[model samples]
Target: MCTYLKNMANYKHSHLKNKSFEEIQMLFNNTLKWIESFVPMDTELVKGSEKVAKGCSKRATYKLEQEDAKRQRIEEENESVE
Candidate 1:
C-alpha cells in the first residue's frame, strides 16, 4: 500500500493535470477512503502513542545534553592547560 502511494507520488503534476475529471475525482475520493480505513481514528490511542514518543524525545534530549556537557568539560580542561 505504501509502495503504491510512493509510486503514485512519482506521477508528475502535469500527468495528473492531464487526467480526466472522473479519474481525478476517483483519486481524490480514494484518498479520503484510504484515510478513513487506514487511520486508527481513536483519540485516546493517538494521545497515548504521542506520549510515548514524547518520552523518547525527552530521553534523547537529556542524553545529548549530557554528551555536550562532557565535551565542554573536556574542552575547558584542555584550555586550562594552555
Candidate 2:
C-alpha cells in the first residue's frame, strides 16, 4: 500500500510538473471535490482517500517548485545575454 501511494505520487508529480501553480491548485481542488462527491452518504469506499490525494498534491507542488527554479535560471541567463 505504501509503495503504491509513493508510485502514484511520483506519477502525479511528473504529470503536473509543467503546469502553473494556479492550474495545479485548480486540479487539486477539483480532485478533492470529486472525491468528496463520493462520500459515505452513498458508499463508505472513499474513507481515508484524502491521504493519497494530499500526497499527490504535495508532490505536484514540489515538482513545480523545482521546475520554477530551473525556469528562472534560464530566464536570467537569457536576460544577461541581451
Which 10-residue window of candidate 2 scores lowest in summed lDDT? 1-10
Q: Which pairs in model 1 have colliding backbones? A: none
Q: State in Å the error of residue 78, model 2.
A: 1.0
Q: What C-alpha lDDT values do all the predictions have?
A: 0.73, 0.67
Q: Which stretches of candidate 2 lie over 4 Å from their true place?
A: 1-45
Q: For candidate 1, lDDT tens digit of each residue in 1-82?
A: 3334336545456657667878766776686587666646477878898989999999999999999999999999999999
**Which candidate gets the maximum lDDT versus the true structure?**
1
Q: What lDDT tens digits, residue by residue, belong to model 2 across residues 1-82?
A: 2233224333355666677778666666666576566657335455457668889999999999999999999999999999
Residue pairs in clash, model 2:
none
lDDT of 2: 0.67
Q: Which stretches of candidate 1 lie over 4 Å from their true place?
A: 1-25, 38-42
